[model samples]
Target: MKPAVLSGVHFITGDVACAEGALAAGCRFFGAYPITPATEIAEHIAGRLPEVGGTFIQMEDEIAAIASILGASSAGVKSMTATSGPGFSLMMENIGLAACTEIPCVIVDVQRAGPSTGLPTQGAQGDMMQARWGSHGDYKIIALSPISPQEIFYQTILAFNLSETYRVPVLIMTDEIIGHLSERVVIPDESEIKLVSRPRAKGRKDRFLPFEPGPNGVAPMAIAGEGYNIHVTGLTHNEKGYPDMTVECQKQMMARLTGKIQNNLDDIIKTEGYMLDDAEIIIISYGVSARTCHTAVDEARSQGIKAGLFRLITVWPFPEDQICRLAERAKALITVEINLGQIHLEVERCVKDKVPTYLVGHVGGTIITPERVIETIKEAT
Candidate 1:
């Protein structure tokens, strides 16, 4: 019997769609602990993984959950895990380990309202900054935000592909609303979906250098027990994968770790612009907040305000170039998010006071209303 994919259009929550997307992306192992708003992802994968001859294990905690997935990926299996805010906090240290060791894995954080378990069932975009800089280091990571079930399905696959291609842990920074919202989703046929696998090391085992980057600045990985001596560690190391404690070694290691994502921003960044061609006022948003901006932009246009939307799909490389370009012509920019102006700071930095910028946001127990966004547009105009 084959693993059944409900291939046709069906109504499902974003978490379930995310699980199906991971399976389609060839994820063979799932290691996670149950958490609110994100539990559905693990539950779906737990039932389906076995059918596809894959593995699913519920770890004792979030720390163990991330650690298990890292070990599985080191053994050459495509792996993933799902969590909410608290669990995501626990996984930070190991997330850094994955970055340093150059492991390919996907970690999904279905964000909830919280500094510490504030609202387990409610949604928030508070984790936006944390997703990029939570792990206490000078490394770069790729993160994506999806507003609907269908988009999350597609983005999940893209997250896996990016993780494998860049040899870094990719994050899906969705919120509780999108994670639990039910909508029609279409799972593409396997032939139509593109998947990326990690590049393997070439040549004799003795000659292999695990940390030596290729022309693309990503080193080809060698799986454990694959006739290659692979040494992976969190400590700064040289090309041979041994611990090297020199200022020069630290500088070289850190540069490549950050450069792999920074230099390839063109490939890693994605955004969508609406009515931006001649707009004087632009609204910037991501995740569920972006959904409301669409309606707000339309309403603002009805009132003779040249309002536009700049929705972020790939949140992390920050879309600095696009934001900077938009600032030149737009009269003002308004950033709407669930948190208290987290991404607004980034928008301000990019604009550099070229255009007036304002933040319309809350502390996140509910969604931002389109009426408020439209009102902000009117005021800005």
Candidate 2:
């Protein structure tokens, strides 16, 4: 067999491709606790890293898993951790730490039914909001959703680039269905992809402030053991890593931490539209559920219904502006997900007054289907 081609590239499963993506993204450190649906990510990385002279550790728990990855990232290694919903919840505190300490790392959350282990092997999109605000505080995060295995591969690499460029933790917000689904994925050559490394302090090492804003608000991070003697902490710290509680210092730190992402959001956020120009009804979804919605919209279009599909590749820093534009012309918006009404609320918020938003959701172990979504769109249109 030669290889499967997509967009003229080869194919692979979302999970396996994710590991390959991480390796290609220059992730040298991986610390993760095994969990259902997402275990393949760790397994693949564990096997692949040794060949690339990288390191992979199966930590005792998700908390330690995330903490270790953050620590590695602080040491100036591109790092990652993979987990499902239950494990993802356990890593919240350290995730907050990564945010405050400005550690660049990637966290892959292959979501399953949640709220205390609702379903282990099943798929769910329940963690959509959690990815945005699971960790405490006001720090912003960037999250990417993959609807297919091929997308998973590409998005994982993009996740690392965004994290490094923004000096923040990036989340690959995948789901059980897509994680396990076997599909073809092409590995792009490095030259064809944009790779962003953390900016380095150019001069005056003695005067270097670890957290000081650079040209884009993201500070260049020097490795802890490096001659720069960089100090990192979770406390609200000033440029010198000393805890600063003054109103001005706090404001400046928060603004820079958030502004890095907000200011460059247009470059980070991505969405795909299908048959949108002629559609009266829009199907909005992300992650694994998006595939179903895409199929639904295609079927609806064939049935003479003006239905379009909007797939959210960047789930966080949500596509409010683009969504608002769609809402203006859309008669109705239908959101489909494996979890009950998680992303549906977001769609409602985006298109509230302009159009009615309908949710086609499933709970526990069930997966939403294209047929059901098409029916909902038909009724709405």
Candidate 3:
């Protein structure tokens, strides 16, 4: 059967549409502190949640905001939180806790100029690395970066699905430019979207092991106070979810935590390519910078330059294989971002010195222009 038509679609800011996407994905619990660019996400959800009989809490700070989302998720509710750079940093500890405890939740980071609140309301793509490893630990995280309001809507849903499927926090690494810019977004119907809930343990409900592995590597999550004596903590624990201090237990637990993401990377990774086949140079980017890069690629092609474009929809996991393949064919790899070359390093790492990579970046409130990217491509050519 064909999917049902989704009509009356219109564009809006990525932040506004992301909130709606969370609602459509059945997010009933929102705990967020207001921050620039991303504040509208919380504001939109705060208004929408009440109409759906859900709970929306403006916590004291980003720390408490993330903690509340974890608490809500443990109670078997689909929950999420949104923030900008500094708030994202504040939530890092609890985000690591969410990683350790395997809590399924979505974190929307509408990135802005950073490194100590550089520009609160302004745009920047400075937090790409932070989104991957900001939390203090040797753990893997799933991060998605959308290029448009339409993608923000769909990626928000994907974030929740991935979180639930793997029982780990998923970050929607949005940028301020896309977050604040309004565009037409066609909201898909609920029935058409594939929503996956965490598997619930059966039988021995009274003795359910919340950390026990299931078929999908995700353990069955029994809600707190749901008549299941489930134990949850941030410590390294055995299958019972208690703190374990032994070396073997710690290794195994860490393995499970990180392995869930690494083992299923193919399902969690997403990217977009344009004219990559037989192209000489491939410009890689994400967020709003990709918009500029796309135009640059077009102009370069018009100028008889064989330039391709690769946009990362899933930022984490880094699209290493795709990058390696494209890098082998291209003379140079140019990474375009709205900050001081965060993801450019990843591109370099993937190519492993096999390709020369150039960083095209900006700071403060400046947006990287298409002309600048075109010039960079011409120089490489």
Candidate 4:
């Protein structure tokens, strides 16, 4: 099988760049439902998947779309799906299954304003918390946010890599603005790109402990058709993957499911700090909200506010250590996003009143301007 490489520089939307990134990341299966702001990703990848020995399926709804990719990943293929808010909510049940079963798949959520389909084409950062805790029960997740088309392309590939390496579903938490924004993007040659494949189950098939935690706390997976005794179920299971409905069994299962991500925080978390070396006030933001923050920081500097930007390239796993340490020396923290205060809540929780934390956000629809961010920075000061 060949990997698709859309090499070189070209002007493209974030949606198209995401598709190319998935292809380049060795994602050979694309299963998705049509939803505005995110539909372009499916539309673009559908035409391209076939050209590189990949499969593209249009599922009836978000639930089926996610299930299809889960099945595809179990069959030893890199798989992914994209959806907006409502569809994202629809997939929560299955996303829990993916977490428990330890399936490797990428889920791109191109968010719009919504509790229930508020805006199809408009952008919002409301689902940051949902992407982390939408599903029932507790299982760790890795989520990435990109500020622009070029970064979205990179983040998508990184999402797949993280998913494969950790054998868990990774979320690409982008908003409609980044999804639809057209800009210059560069797709490097296949040789220049780095990709990660899941660790295939090794040793004798008969004695293989499918759910046994390895050194990294992640079990080596046995692909379905490869013939190892693979019992992939959401039920609390042992190393042998048999259903065990007892407290002891549930405890062990939860440890494996959540431990792998918790142990590798350094590897899974990514963030970019700008002008933070000596900054007194920090602007914490992610996705589209982080876009104008660069200008806001610059403008804050021009006015001598000593403000800096903390860009959450990776949102999930919370980066609490970094936030806490930054808060220790900083005078204030301003969380910026389209939502009223989803991520801001997390920021506040991390700071624990060490420094003042404020939110500069709205319900949704429009992008937050640099001037607004600067205003918030001023208020925080």
Candidate 5:
């Protein structure tokens, strides 16, 4: 029998690393429909899962794919699904359902350029805003950007831990570049890796309230067949998990749904800063674009430009306060992203006219090179 962790060094694409990462994190169920740039993950995990005593299913489509994961997660299994642009769009409605019902699951979106199937094979980070707002209504979700195959592995594990801890869906915001790029990923022993399972409900099953939050503002989850009165729904619910459509129920439910994530931002968000202490110019980016930012920052510094790099590991919460602090002291801020200007607007919003903000924006189908970023730095000055 194959080991669950698949411990050791290996050369692999980011997609395979992601599949291995999910297994290492104790993910037992994967439900996805094959989609371009993201289908390899489902194919890889499908074979590996059976060896590890897990389940993998290819549903009718992306909608059913995500719906299956939500149902699987409700039964107290760690669940995930992967897709590209069009499929990701199809999963939005059910993604919102996961949020409303506080189901712990992960969605891997290896984004391709698109408003509607713009590019299938080419890479793009065009899904940044959609990851946060694609699902309707007001909900707080976590999204992580991995710079490489190695980091995507770790980020995948982190996604599961956070979902279980917060009882909310987490997103791995990857792109086709990193998703298909080959790299060396070191898989350590299972003993060294950290894993988190959902907070299980205890005490008498008769009085169990599935939606009632514990001390951390996140409710303990009751499995579907665990004899608990689990009443999961997408509608406004009271602590008893029953539909409560009144004003008080709406407000109370909304508060916890958003607050559980907002209140715990410190734990959920992760970012990296380099050469920032005395920076007059700040270049912000994430995912594969961030790989170029690293070189761009070095090139700027070599040219005697007081530039620094602020790479976002977690994108959804937006890192508003951190960007604001940097903006206050920096002479300028530049956002590098493949989208025309999704994250750039957020950076400009956080700057609040404090600094002259600029965007090194790209439409799709390519990467913004370090030289292009340096050119923007010269222009910003």
Candidate 6:
């Protein structure tokens, strides 16, 4: 099949940009629900997928949405889904299932303010922790937070590549502001866009072990109906793809699941550092808040505060080593987010008294302004 790349620049919302990214990345199946701040993504892809001979299904709900994506992916198709906080919560069980069964799929959570349906249209980074631990268990996940329409486009493609490479559910954790905001996005040609396909199982079908890992701790997957002995279950299973309830089997299975991503941190973790070379106070932020933090850092620099900005593009692996290195050199660390102290705790953990850590955040329904971030920077100094 010909690649479905719209090779040009277009002014579009982040949600629309994301859909285009998925299409460019060769995502052939999208199973999603209509949820606020994220519905535009589903709407755009639903129209576009059919044009490329892809499938787009609006499931009855979020749970079924994710389940269907997993099914499609197991059939050797690149699949994805998009939702907001409530819908994301509903998909948690299946998210874990995707992780346990080693399925490749992307989940986009365009976050809105919420404990439970708190604000449908407002933006918040409250789901940072949930994106990491929402699914029950000790599996590792990859999550990217985008600050703009252009970035979300690239990040969505990256999300798919990572999911396929590691055989895990990757998340694009955008917010209402970024999702609804429109800007210029450059869509590269099919030849220019990098795509990663899942590693397919090779060797005799009769001798194939579905869950056996290679040197990288990632197993080559076999699609259903490929004539290989494929047995997939959420329960602990052996390399032969049969359930094994022994503690040793559980230990080995868990290690491969988590180790695949953790061992490849150099490739998976991405962050941007601004003016960090000669700064005493560092402001760490992600998503929409990072934009404000950048402005605040510039303002602080104008006032001779020696401040810097550390923006997280990949948030899930936590980027502990980089944060720790920055903490050791900087006098203080400030974490800015729309939610109250979710990523702040992570900063504090990394710092561990190496430097004082401060949180400049608030409850959702509104954004944290540059002035407020500047004020916190001054206070820290």
Mark the 10 consecutive residues where model 6 has the least summed lDDT: 1-10
TM-score of each: 0.99, 0.95, 0.96, 0.98, 0.99, 0.99
**lDDT tens digits by residue: candidate 4, 1-381:** 444887889899999999999988989899989999899999999999998999999999999999999999999999999999999999999999999999999999999999897988899988988999999999988999999999988988899989989999999999899999999999988898898888889999999999887889888889988889688788888889999999999888888888899889999888999999999999999988887888899999999899999989989988999999998999999998899899889899999998998899998999989999888788888
- Candidate 3 per-residue lDDT, tens place, 113-153, comes to 97897888888888888888888878878999999999998
User: Which wins on lDDT, candidate 2 or candidate 3?
Assistant: 3
Could you tell me which 10 consecutive residues in candidate 3 have the lowest summed lDDT?
1-10
**Clashing pairs in model 2?**
10-185, 11-184, 11-185, 12-184, 12-185
Off by over 4 Å in 6: 1-3
Cα-based lDDT at residue 29, candidate 2: 93
**Model 2 CA deviation exceeding 4 Å by range:** 1-11
lDDT pick, better of 5 and 6: 6
Candidate models: Cα lDDT each = 0.93, 0.84, 0.87, 0.91, 0.93, 0.94
Tell me how far candidate 4 lies from the true structure as C-alpha RMSD in angstroms.
1.0
lDDT of 6 by residue, 1-381 (tens): 444888898999999999999998889999989999999999999988888999999999999999999999999999999999999999999999999999999999999999999899999999999999998989899999999999999999999999999999999999999999999999887888899999999999999999999877889999988989699999999999899999999999998999999899999999999998998999999999999998899999999999999999999998999999998899999999999999999999999998888998888878899999999899999
Across 242-303, the per-residue lDDT of candidate 5 in tens digits comes to 99889999999999999998988898889999898998889999999989988998999999
Give Cα distance to truth, residue 118, candidate 1, Å.
Answer: 0.5
List ranges where model 3 is wrong by over 4 Å. 1-7
Error of 6 at 30 (Å): 0.4
Lowest-scoring 10 consecutive residues by lDDT in candidate 2? Answer: 1-10
